[model samples]
Target chain A: MVEAWQWVTKHPDKLAGWTLEHIWIVSVAIAIAVVLGVALGIYISRPGKEHIADSVLYLAEIMMTVPSLALFGLLMLILGTIGLKVIGFLPAVIALVIYGQLPILRNTYIAIREVDPAMIEAGKGMGMSERQLLFKVKLPLAVPIIMAGLRNAIVLLIGITAIAAIIGAGGLGVPIFRGLRNARMDLIIIGGVSVSILALVVDGLMGRVERWVTPRGLKRR
Target chain B: MIRLDQVTKIYPDGTEAVNEVSLEVGEGELCVLLGPSGCGKTTTMKVINRIIPITKGKIYIDGTDTTKIDEDELRRNIGYAIQEIGLFPHMTVGQNIQVVPALKGWPKDKRSERAEELLELVGMNSAEFMNKYPSELSGGQRQRVGVARALGADPPILLMDEPFGAIDPITRVRLQDEFLKIEQEIKKTIIFVTHDIYEAIKMGDKIALMNEGRLVQYDTPSNLLFKPKNEFVEQFVGADRALKGLQLIRVKELMTGTPPLAKADERVVTVQARMEREGVDCLAVVDNEGKFLGWVDRVNVGKGETVRDIINRSVATATANAVLSEALSLMLSSGFKTLAIVDGINKLEGVLSFDAIQLALSEVAQRRGSE
Candidate 1:
């Protein structure tokens, strides 16, 4: 414990760099996931597309079942064949984004689908065009639930991002792997602790964002 | 003014919701489309605003064909409300009420001012309710906000499909009365849809009674009650048509102007002699200015020196403007054979009697029989 504390204090800059890298990878991957997932969600949730939505949701569920490391390996292989970087940031982001799809996609689809039909009817009756109804009524009402999914994707990506170090993606995982290779307990402890703290801080920030974006009328007193 | 010329709506599934229904609602008229569920009353109303598109025929709004206008533009000019209220839960009451105005690109201050004006018009205090969400409001309050929202842009035409249907019975009646009062001031040409017979009678200047997707009869509430076009119309109006007709007649219409009355300073014996001459058991005692003081009955006339000495201040009285149905209920509940019809300040106007109400009903029956 004493050794771990001293090492962390002495190498604060190194710790900060790894934490920033971890945050960057997770943020970028989750951002892409949100766009793709929400767009797909809206597309699939349109009327007469229930079968397509069901099949897409099923595919997302199947993708979620793939182990993170195995999915990363699969992406590495696929990207290598496509003449892209076989290891590091590209594959790591790709893997995290794939993993992030289920929560964000499912939530967006369900949130949009679950909006009250009567509200949509009322909007139409009041002369709101289809586009106006989507932006003004449906999307605003779906924000809280979609944010829940976003938070889930973000937290999941942050944790999984540490594993990217194996492919030389360079996050807090680098220290833990190096510590294991050299039998350094203090290094491993610092890396593990930093990743945990990073996940918690990011999750807390996302929680605040979720609450902020939620419509005031939707909030429970 | 709105006119439907043989408007027909047959859904894609081959269900004819509104079949060749022709009706005209004049400017500022509150026309009720009343019928049983699945009778296409709601469908007929929705057709006016093109919410449910008509498959055949045409609707004309103030001499312009509805199809000639852009649907959104047409709908924007026609205020719409439904039974569910459908108030956007995420919006504040003010925001909800300002939706159409905001859509029309009104300046923010103007839109908000309109919302405040409408909220007050619906009996909601803007200060207390402007920022509150629909979820925070009670059902009746939400309903009022729904109505306020419908009147947002001050549309000359309004389509209300059971706007008060979801409220409790007492609140529903209150809301209806308040809405009618609002209608009087705004004078918008409104097409109100409801299944409740009493609501149709109370709210509609003219009722378009539909059945099985066809116009069964279109007439005033009194005509619908007394001169039903056919057996179906009579049955639909129900067996208690005469009693329902009472709802249409105001107390002042049947009330006798020459009511048995005694001055507060008049001798009790003299008032008793007058009551006997008028063939009434009681006389409405009034002050010198004709402001109603109380009542003096034959039984108490002999025990007092003056009418004021035995005046029964608890005697039930109705306003001259009150419907006979209200007067009847007040008389029945208060165990009075006659009600002194007074003005707002309790000045004696006339007397509404049980016998007069009976005579009114028999006269209506005789008129129906002669017809």
Candidate 2:
């Protein structure tokens, strides 16, 4: 423990830089996943499109069942075969984003479903067009649930991001990978502890953001 | 004013929800569409607002074919309230009430003022309730908010689908009373749907009873009770149609002239003599201006005391405009044979007695028998 703490203290600047990089990559991946998932969820959830929604949800569930490491390796090989660069951040991010899509898409579908059917009737009865009902009533009510999905994605991606360093993504995962190659117990412990601390901080902040964005009437007192 | 000429609605699953039904509701009239579950009353109402498009036939609002006007615009001009209320749980009472006005792009200050005015109109304390969410309110309060929201834009037409059906019986009665008062003031052309016959009789100027996706009868509550066109309507209105008919007669119709009154300052002996001279056990005590103070029962009078001191202040009373049914309930509940009918300022206008109510109903029965 003393040796690990010493190592962390000795390379504070490098650790900080890598932690920032890790946060950036995960944030981007999650952001993209959210946009794509929410759009697709809304599309499939429309009337006459329920079967499509079910099919998409089933596919997302199957994607979630695939092991993340194997998915990443498959993506790396596909990118290499396609003659595209596969050694660094792009493949890592693509893997994280693909892995992040299932929760966001599934949660968005469930959240939109959670909106009261009576509310939709009320909206239309009160003269709201389809667009207005979706934007003003359905989306606003679904947001808190969607944010919860985002929170899950954030935590999951934060953990998965550490693994991204194996492909030269240069995150906090670098130390753990280097320590594994050299059998340096101190570096390994420092990486593991910092990643945990990083996850905790991100999770806490995401929770606050979720609460802030939620409608006050829907909030837990 | 709203008119429906042979409207029909058929669900996509080959179910006929509303058959060809033609109806007309005059301006400022409270028209009730009443029926049992799956009787197509709700479908008929939804067709008015274009929430459910009619499968056949035409509907006109103020002589404009509904399909000619923009559906959204047409709907915005018509107020709507439903059984479940559909209050946005995430909004405060004030925000919920301001929905239509806000949708119409009324200035914020005006919308806020309108919300407060509507809250007061619905008998909720605006300052106290404006900031509270729907979940914070009881079912009755939320229903009130639903009504206030519907009236926010002050539209000339209102469409209500069992709006009070979810409230408890007691609250439903109170809300019915409050809505009647509001209706007298606003005079909107209202189409209210309900499964309860009593509610339809109490609130509607004309009741349209439906069954099997078709309107069976459309007429005034009294006409529907006294002049049923068929056995279906007679059975639908039930066995106590006469009692329901009596509820439509206001106290103002059957009430007799006010009884002799004693001034509040009159000596108890003098009041007692007045009651005895009038051959009555009690005399109403009024102020010098003839405003009703209360009533004095002979048993409570003391020779040395004044009428004010001997009066029963807790006696049940009714307004002259109150329906005979209201007086009947009040008298029955309080064990009073007569109800003092007061005017707006509590001045004694007349009295409603059990004899007068009996006489009214018996006369109607006699007229029917002769016919």
Q: Supply the global lDDT for candidate 1.
A: 0.87
Candidate 2 residue spans exceeding 4 A from truth: A81-84, B255-296, B302-322, B340-351
lDDT of 1 at B77: 95
Residue B197 Cα positional deviation in candidate 1, in Å, after optimal superposition:
0.8
Residues B1-371 of candidate 1 have per-residue lDDT tens digits of 89999989998989988899999999999999999899999999988878888999999999999999998889899999886559998999999998899888899999999999999999889999999998899999989999999999999999998999877875775677668668879999999999989888878899999999999999999889888899889899999877787777777788888476788888888887888788978888788788987778888866879877898888777766566777888789778787888764678888888998988878767766776
Interface RMSDs of the predictions, in order, are: 0.9, 1.0
Q: Per-prediction DockQ, in order? A: 0.60, 0.64
Candidate 2 residue lDDT tens string, B1-371: 69899998988999998999999999999999998899999999989988888999999999999999998898899999986558987789998888888889999999999999999999999999999998899999999999998898999999998889777876776678778878989999999999988888888899999999999999998888888889989998888766776777778878889788888888888878888888998887788777887778887876448877777777777776567777788889878687898864578898888999988788767655664
Relative to the true interface, what fraction of contacts does candidate 1 keep?
A: 0.69
Model 1 residue B284 CA deviation in Å: 13
Error of 1 at A189 (Å): 4.7
Local lDDT at B361 for model 1: 77
